[model samples]
Target: MSGARGAWWARIPEPVLDAVVVVVAVVDVLINLDDTSGPAWAMATLACAALIVRRRFPLPVFLLTLPASLMLDIVFAPFAALFTLSERSRDRRLLVTCALLFAVASATPWPLDDLSSHERAWTLVYFFYTLATAAAPVLLGQLVQARRDLARRLVEIEEAREHERLLHSQAVLARERAQLAREMHDVVSHQVSLIAVQAGALQVAAKDPDFREGARTIRSLSVDTLDELRHMVTLLRASGGRSTELTPQPTLADLHKLVTTSGIDAELTGELPPDVSSTAQRTIYRTVQEALTNVRKHAPGATATAHLWHDGDAFGVTVTNTPPARPSLPLPGSRQGLIGLKERAELLDGTFASGPTGDGGYEVRLRIPNRAG
Candidate 1:
């Protein structure tokens, strides 16, 4: 209940709070104006007015209230100023000095007159009493300041915890993706590869024309399916964004073998520089692999040509395929292969383009700077 009230009190506007403080100080000064002189009245008025700017100039405002404290038996003006000073000032020495000055000003007689030794002792006793009393506001102000600091620190610690939780969630998701990729590669891919190999053997051994043709179709579709599965597995394994490899990455050296096993009539021509980086070689291999797979699925009975060449400051591969001699079989596809290839090329500071040729053929091209990895 007290916390709620404090929060509501904090919501009050600064100017309104300042005005209320000034009015309270003025009332305190008026109550003690019974036998005070003109100078006392003037000092009291100045002190009340000075409260209006106490927050902006705490030390100076506290000094202005000292004269009224010395003459009039008023407590609000000086205490208010002292509290403001203590709340704002971080220097312990300055606060101690201010508190001592307030104590001396309040305890001393207005006129400097000769006093007996006993009277001087009594005055010394009054000064210590007032000094102890002045400590209340100072301690309260310091407590408030420490509370504000602790609140800010708590907010920062909460934000740090929230960020740590988000990172932990991402780490869990990456591990799950890695597990899924392993299942697809080890179980699903192996079974599909066996089916493709069996279909190829049957196509060669079968004597009936229709049976051989059906077996060839099965082998071609199986190969295409396996290619897509490999791309998906690669993406899932790399989802963690780490450099560690879970499988042997293909490079330009494997290009000939890829073409031979593609289940399509494809020819690889030309060659890249032998000094090409491993990353760039892998990119080239994937590009050619995806293009030939597209040809097999979208352009049945089409012959494809993959040509690698270097020109000026760039080097890349271009895969072009003749138009399909027969209608393509309907195949399931997520259609993200080309998008993935385009993204991969962009990562290497390269470009990818694919469209139909003027002769109704399809062409896909990838280009990367010679200096790119």
Candidate 2:
């Protein structure tokens, strides 16, 4: 109900406001006036006209109303005009003006006839008290407005800061993903190119039966590796497209291809747990890939053993290889594959470690917690 009235009041025009304030002020003067035939009534009416622009020019309103209030006091009229003047012109600057007007007006003779000194002092006290009362509402309104504006500004700043942080994080993640894709492309492209070149040479040397058989095996491994690598690239592209591409994730089922491509003889040891799911399976596969790549590059003549063991809540994989007895040939490429695998495992709250064993063999170990736990 009050809201409806406020909405109605908002549609009132400036001209209407001028007419209303003048009417109210004139009514107030006439209601309390004992005699209404002098300069006091004229001054009061002029003061009402001056109040129409109080919001735009409060200082002028203060000046106009102060003198009018003094004139009203001189006419033996009630002192309500001074109180009304203070109500109309009480802001930060106008409060000081009002206090000054009160002090100056108190020094003059009262409109009351033959007043006692005590009665005069009481009237002066009443004037100051009225000025204080008028200042209370304006000061409280200003404080409430300042607090509400401050809270609104703080909320806006926090939302903007959070948006900036999200954008920065997305940019960093995009850069890292692009770098990883580039590295994978370089590694796969090099290995595939080598296999293709070697296969072409073997086809030419087919007359030499012994060399031909070895070349055929290399060719086969090369073809299979290329197919797998292409599938991986497709999967990356598709998943990166919509993130719902359900091209089957690699699992322990593909372990044989890894061994064959590495050109290493691996003796598998244990059974994979029934509960080993997508995440752990991928981690294991990548670990084997990295280990075998290192074996082919660094341990050329060494044999590797791939083992998987499941006991209770933890599952483990070990890839151990006897290193080349002779001086190590230059290891090909930057060896960041195992480092990346370790980081992947750690992100899933697993453990991974790889280094040379005391018995002149390289060993890579990984342990992942089972899902049932």
Candidate 3:
């Protein structure tokens, strides 16, 4: 019971176990001694006393006290020593040596005389008994060691799975944060565009040429500010694909314009649904624009491709790019553009996805319902 490991309650304290060994040795010495041989009993008792440290220095205690067995046959100390040695290292050499010593000593005819020398049959019988006695501790030690190994491996696997779960949780949190950024833009960006359009109207209405020029300047500044805000929102969203394509430089229906104007080498194909709402069209436009921007930032000279089409209940935009044409700029990217695109599509009850292609390139795709309603 004391030998079972991996749980605290199964153990016996070392000092108590040592005390038990000492008491047993004393009793053994008392029982085996002849009534006239007080001095010999005292000497044998001293040798067996070494069992008190049998678990600590098992081999040393076993070897030093083995002679005590020659006088009265002390079994506990040697058995405990053998068990401890096998438990610690599973060393074959030490186990075999201890077993051989026990076998030889157990078979030896004591108080040497000619009658004892002739008892070969008795010697063989005692040898087998001692060998089996030596084997019991070894088998038990191996069992305990095996159990301990299994427990350790199970603990490691659990920890590894816990680490993976934490990583997955962090990834989800990042996506939610990106979605929040896109929502913020949705709330504020439209007002800014309205202000820019009003400034342009003011420029056209002014009669004095100098006053008209001032209004024109104001309008220009407002437009520029709106563009910058959109850029910032796109970067924060990580879903922003191409900022350039998204900003309505061309009509939303023209997918070819998005691929051509983004400055990345790329191709465009497919037709848009004629009845698509302006809202759905804008979402697809921003998606393609963000994809192109991502290609420019991450892939540099890589060729890009765009496919715009209508999928039954939804309008789809797919943008893909070849691997980078040149070494990347050392600058880090915000990835807001991609996130913003994803947020835009989802808000319209659509889907968005992006990943690497098999040939080391990248792809981004978005789908939105044909009508904002």
Each prediction's RMSD to truth: 22.4, 26.0, 19.9
Better lDDT candidate (2, 3) = 3
Q: Give the TM-score of candidate 3.
A: 0.48
The CA-based lDDT of model 3 is what? 0.70
TM-score of each: 0.61, 0.39, 0.48
For all candidates in order, the CA lDDT equals 0.86, 0.64, 0.70
Residue 162 of model 3 has an lDDT of 75
Better of 1 and 2 by lDDT: 1
- What ranges in model 2 sit over 4 Å off? 1-23, 73-115, 172-373
- Candidate 2 C-alpha lDDT tens digits along 1-373: 2333356655798778667766776666566566655776776777767666665665566566655556554311112233334344424575556555644553444353777889778777867765565455445544544444445445444554675587566556555554555566688757786887889697777898888888887888888887777777655554442222222356788887767755556666677876677778888888887787677556645789989987777887899999653233343466678779889788678899899999888999988877522
Task: Estimate, for each residue in 255-280, the C-alpha lDDT of model 1 and write its tens digit.
Answer: 99989977779999999888889999
What residue runs in model 1 are displaced by over 4 Å at the alpha carbon? 1-6, 241-373
Q: By the TM-score metric, which is better: model 2 or model 3? A: 3
Question: What TM-score does model 1 achieve against the real structure?
Answer: 0.61
In model 1, the worst 10-residue window by lDDT is 240-249
Which pairs clash in model 2?
none
